[model samples]
Target: MQLAVLGSPIGQALSPVLHRAAFQALGLDWTYHAIDCTPDRLASFLGELDDTWAGLSLTMPLKQSVVPLLDRASDTVVRTGAANTIVVSDGQLIGENTDLYGMTQALSDAGVTTACGVTVLGAGATACTALAAAHELGCDRATVIARNAGRARQFLGPAAERIGVKVRITPWTTAPAHLEAELVISALPPGAADELAPLWKPAAGTLMDVLYRPWPTPLAQAAATAGRRVIGGLPMLVHQAARQVELQTKCPRPPYEDMLTAASAAVHQLDTTT
Candidate 1:
């Protein structure tokens, strides 16, 4: 069978390393690869897949875009309006979102139990998952920061309701002087949160920056400097991919250490070069 992660500028993705390791460990004769799939090209690419194609991991621009292409989506997808995993079964494409689980696992691993208030930076597809994850972590209220207030409000409105969290919107440029949430989730792309890093001061809690590459992102570094517990996105990425593997292969318990080891090696290689 075949599986791959699809995204733009996907060459740097460590998904291949992780998946290949998992397949080898499980003795599965499966092949995993990465394909540069831009938003405009996703449809053409989907059309060419055959039975051998098992599943796909969508990233960035394609997460929300792939919604319409699916025969059906999981509850997470319906609520978040985004999907990261698509399983091709019997000529039907089924969409799902393992991100929420991944995010929850990451936060739990970082020692976050129950959050009364959650603050999320950036209002994109991933931010939707962040909101859902916050709710899963027992957060009653969520404050989302986005450049465009109208767009943020519209998108986060239903998502917040579905997650059972009261919603509040904040302009990106006018972030509050004191962000005192029990947990702060930075869902912005690489480097996007750097400039605002200094402005963030949490009375207590952890900071999770959803960007793993380049090792210490400025935001993460700043958070660390402030003596806050910091979690990078790699653990979340690994966990989510493991869920995808379980779904596609029907292996309830896929060996995850192999994947984490592979991912760590790739991160080490990147670290040495930088």
Candidate 2:
């Protein structure tokens, strides 16, 4: 079977590396690659797929954009308005979000099992998943800091409600006020929140920056320097890709450690080469 991670500016995507390591460890002769696909080309790309394709992983702009193009979507997709995984089951295209699961697992590995209040940065599709993960971690209230309130509320409002969390969306200026939350997730893309790094307050809560390529993002660096626990996006990326492998291959035991090794190596290679 074949699978690929799809998105524009997919240069930094490591889903293929993670999934390839997963399939290899599972002893499956499956192939996973990365494709440069944009929102406008998503439909055409799906239309061109053959039975050889088993699953797809989406990133960035393609996550929310591909929702309307799926034959069916999971409840998480319905509520969150985003999905990063698509499984070609039988003859139907099924959309699912493994990000929430990924985040919880990633946090658990970092010794965070419960959070009461959370502050999320950059309310995008990944922020929706961050909210869901917070919910799973026993959080009932969240504060979202985003540059665009409309887009943030559009996706986060219903997702929080359905996931049973009360979320308040605020402008980026109010971000520092909520730095004391039990867990703060920087769902922003790399470098997007660099300006706010200088404003990062020393707090007791953990900070999870959802960008792995450059290791310590400015925000992450500030948080760490301030004595806050920090988690990079690599572990979350591996966990989510492992879930996608399970969904696509029906493999009960996906080798997450192997995938982590491969993903870490790939990230290091990209970081050094470019």
lDDT of the structure predicted as candidate 2: 0.88
Best by lDDT: 2
TM-score of 2: 0.96
The models' CA-based lDDT, in order, is 0.86, 0.88
What digit string (tens of lDDT, one per residue) describes model 1 on residues 1-274?
Answer: 9999999889788889888888898899999999999989998898888999999999878998999988889999998999999999998889999999888888888788678878899898899999999888777788888878899988888878876788888887666643556678998888888887786664557888888887689888878877778899999999998898899898899777889889999999988887
* Top candidate, metric TM-score: 2
Q: Candidate 1: global Cα-lDDT? A: 0.86
TM-score of each: 0.95, 0.96
State each candidate's clash count. Answer: 0, 0
Provide the RMSD of all predictions against the true structure, rounded to 1 decimal.
1.5, 1.3
Model 1, residue 104: what's the lDDT? 88
